[model samples]
Target chain A: MKKNLSEDFSMEDSLEQIIQEKNLVYRPTRLMTGATLSYCPGCGHGTIHRLIMEVVEEMGIQAETIGVSPVGCAVLAYDFMDVDFTEAAHGRAPAVATGIKRLWPDKYVFTYQGDGDLAAIGTAETIHACNRGEQICIFFVNNGIYGMTGGQMAPTTLEGMVSSTTPYGRNVEQMGPPLKITELVAQLAGTYYVSRQSIHKAATVRKAKKAIRKAFEVQKEKKGMAFVEFVSNCNSGWKMTPNEANQWMEDHMFPFYPLGDIKVDGKLVKNVIQDL
Target chain B: MAKVRGAIVVDIERCKGCEVCVVNCPTDVIAMSKDVNSKGYHYAYMEHPDDCTGCTNCAIVCPDGAITVYRIKN
Candidate 1:
């Protein structure tokens, strides 16, 4: 009986029909290459990469944008993103981005750096670039520990946060307090837009995307440095499940690195620190 | 008014089975599969296809960019 059936009854035809009828609401942006991300499962790095690429695609600036990724887990970021990318030395992404932006003048330049690369060894370059009002966007991912190096205590590691080096958790007096690099950079006169965001949840993801778009827009206007900090989670480093890490980030990390704009339109938006 | 229906395609290879989408799905439409992918992770799939609104919440929160959402009006 089945032999008499029409060829249109084939499985492929039905799938084609279904696909033709449905509207594609969301698909992975083409700006991201087919390379599987090196980031661990549930890491925010992939999401941030997607958001930045999506913004560049939506703005029709894919050809005009250049990215600099320095040492750390994201050192191989260029392999995943399709846009033009340059690999900088450890903690030198900001300087590389500055050079690129200065050379091109019209090109949109940005840097992707991790907490260890940005807040620790690269602190001098980060501050100097921002202080000089380099026309570039800085995407800082602060997971609080050296994720790539087996979870060493980073400069931004929260006080009392356990790490491989700090087996007893971070000691504030000895290690000093966790550096609020986002807030510190915001105090620089050159930064035009400085904001901190997280991408753990759907709502926060949307807000983070908006912040990234704003940063790019600020760059397009030839404004001073636009710094965006993403307070992310390092599940592997933290020894927690992906979901548990996000929840822990909410409960602990958010209190110290609150998500919001510290500066806007070349002016300080709010005093993030009461004492300082 | 026609009823709106939504569906999703999970790229099995790309999904890392992190369960971020499972927790973010508003309709409870997604769940980790008992079967494992090539990477040995329990990837996410639509367990309740009829309930999905194509809100894109799961896709938005997906760290691996493995899920693509589609919607149709009946």
Candidate 2:
């Protein structure tokens, strides 16, 4: 049953208030409905989390889907998202997701991990999971440093950035070099799709939304392992405002970790999800 | 006589306490409360509704669509 409103008791002339109540460009969103997040004011995690949630909500998969979260600040991610989510051991999300997804093949399983988790400790799980060609979605958030436990140098840390662990800046002689996650993941034969996108600007956000949706679609079709590593920012951990952090990423990070698709199965065809 | 009927009302449950309302409001009538609601979203209220001046900037910026302010003549 639909509710309709009749003419109100009060009638106004041409001076009535005008409202642009329809065709909204975007809404705040309902996916992030719990605790006042502890994320710093300018962190990109919030925005990426919100985008993923919105996609899940729109896809109506939250009810049947379960997410494997990492031990980083994103460990509490399950609280922010409405989907049925499980907290994985630090850097073990890919393995956890692989196990759960195999058991409950009908359910949508995705792993949300950070740079430290994905590129460092869980590197084997991630590489092998994608190598084995498991059917699942992996949303890798690369913020360039350890965010939750403290700002420490991460595997994805750039060449000359100072972190709590590397104050003098990462020296290749000692630290080797920053790992390019997307490029590394692309080398895996099992991964069917891979793209690196960010949620910083509107255009990038739109593309990221689409790419995320595509990854889910690939999983739905059982194509193979799908991965999306968003070059997100950690304004708080990096000690910068939202705008400042975005600028830093564009100026410094983007050059080191350029954004785009590293691999894809060009032959497989399916209906493209509008927003993804 | 012109009646003061136009005012935006916020749905406290849906407000995420993001303060987009407080920050985006042109007239600056919206404010987030330190108290928590049942759903746990921070409740936003009309502190200086008088200063609204019929502007819907608060409603427009709300990501949750948790506000409804309108003018009604009786």
Candidate 3:
């Protein structure tokens, strides 16, 4: 804390200087509960959670917003976020979110889902929700493998990525290609906006937050389904340290999943969006 | 150009001591505290407080949302 000092300076002057020098510019949003997050150190889930709550708080939609928590690592999202939430079975968040959104068309509704929950078991629910043009936002956290279920191979796992189930690295010929679920959803005519983002770097976090805020705005506009997929890291699942996982993700994940808007305003995003 | 000063407050109890903030800080302003929090992890502190530019990079990278940032222009 900085203070003003002079022969004539009063305590009030010092207090005023302190207040001016230390005004808060950024902090955790009140939308998050005080409970400590259970995610492992450096897990992207925490960052994504903060970004979502920050967006919701900025939009002043906490009271009317309804979120659907999937059965994966984010299953306990309701406990952390200070908003209305409905629990969904594994991969069924889209279905649940669709129901809530259809009933209360004015309320902002979204789904917090993981790759395992959405791509593997809930693929149908996810595709159908977007296909039906449900007015909702879908926040998909794709950390490649199923972090909660002991590092099992998920539908979004990279072709050569190693998981508990794929001890020798995934065989592309046998396992098929990694699922580009976000691209698939973008291809549907119902989606209004679709983007793939990450939170590993500070600049990327800002972009991801903007993407989420745009998706929320789309929901408020009564636009079709807005899907924002966050390609994240799972340190424990990958058996790597937090820093190492982030480095590994940058080197490996970005090559395949990449990042940028796949669709915007119900039209295909320009091809120039792809990274070299 | 105006001089830049930055302030940061880390919720020690809420911090998991992951050090993501420490690593991401551009000015080397943050460091692991010698003292541990309730969770037995060494929380982060502003080791070089005067060096902070208030860029908010540490807060942006903090996974636990434990840090808040403030900036002053002089």
Candidate 4:
């Protein structure tokens, strides 16, 4: 039986012989470590992480890039990304990134933050960093809920959205309207480039990649702050399948938080979505 | 002129069976495996391998970055 099995194996080609290096089209960037991501399946955090790493690798700035991870689901970003990383206190990524960039003006510094950390706990830090025109990039992932904390309603939670804290859906009357932190930051004179994008579909992923690359380029040019907001989906937190969550995001979230450039090169773009 | 053929290698252990890549493949060449991986998720595989286009759509939408695409002109 052992001799027969060995003979059968010899008849089939090995995997290495089947897949040649020259035929490769796309592979994960080496900037990402081999560690298995901790994010739930279908969560946008993984895609966003890969995009950022791809940008860093493509631009040949792996050694010069510094990322400040926030206190949310992506706090373990340091584990997944093979780049220089520093952990920030709850909602203080912007402040931490500011200091890092100030000390090394030539290094590219950026913060990876979630809605709970940026729009809620770190509101003051976020505003001040942008207001001061810090030479850093802020990558905000707005999933509308505190995913790391078991689906609690965050400051950016949309109206009528349901979360663990908001059992009956978010009520604007009492809880106050959902904060538009991206637009608010774009209004500040310090921000150089500001854009809102998503990564659910292939086309959108391409656009998000461009936005990330642009943000880093803006920093390399010693420009003022560049803020990119990604309206993402939290499948586990939102209690929906990955596909359903993405569709729901398009149907509801995109209307509330439209995807487009709010500001570019220190100038505000007109025709901003005004309907609340 | 040769026909453009493509293939994809999926990291089974890393895949969570989210089905995002299955839905995004333009050629509809990918499908969920009837067998589950060690993690008990129905991982994706190229059901119609001859139909692949090396578009990179699946890799782009794969949140886990498990899919790698390769192309050959045959």
| Full-model lDDT for every candidate | 0.90, 0.74, 0.86, 0.91
Q: Model 3, which residues run further than 4 Å from truth?
A: A1-22, A270-276, B1-4
Standalone chain B TM-score for every prediction: 0.90, 0.78, 0.90, 0.90
- Estimate the Cα RMSD of every predicted model relative to the unseen true structure: 4.0, 8.0, 3.8, 4.9
* Candidate 2 lDDT over residue span B1-74, tens digit each: 33333466677765666564575566677787878888675678877654655555555434344666654434
Q: Which candidate model has the greater DockQ, 3 or 4? A: 3
Q: Tell me the lDDT of model 1 at A29.
A: 92
Whichever of 1 and 3 has more TM-score, that candidate is 1
Cα lDDT of model 3 by residue, A22-114, tens digit? 467887888999678888888888999999999999989889999999998888999998899989988889998988988899999999999
TM (chain A) per model: 0.93, 0.87, 0.91, 0.93
DockQ score for candidate 1: 0.48
> What is candidate 1's CA lDDT for residue B18?
93
Runs of candidate 2 with Cα error greater than 4 angstroms are A1-25, A266-276, B1-74
The candidate that wins on lDDT is: 4
Docking class of 2: incorrect
Prediction 3 TM-score vs. true: 0.92
- Tens digits of per-residue lDDT, candidate 1, B1-74, equal 22326778899999999998988998898999999998898999888765878889999888889988887645
Tens digits of per-residue lDDT, candidate 4, A23-91, equal: 888998888897999999999999999999999999999999999999999999999999999999999
TM-score of each: 0.93, 0.74, 0.92, 0.93
Query: On a 0 to 100 scale, what is the lDDT of residue B13 in model 1?
Result: 95
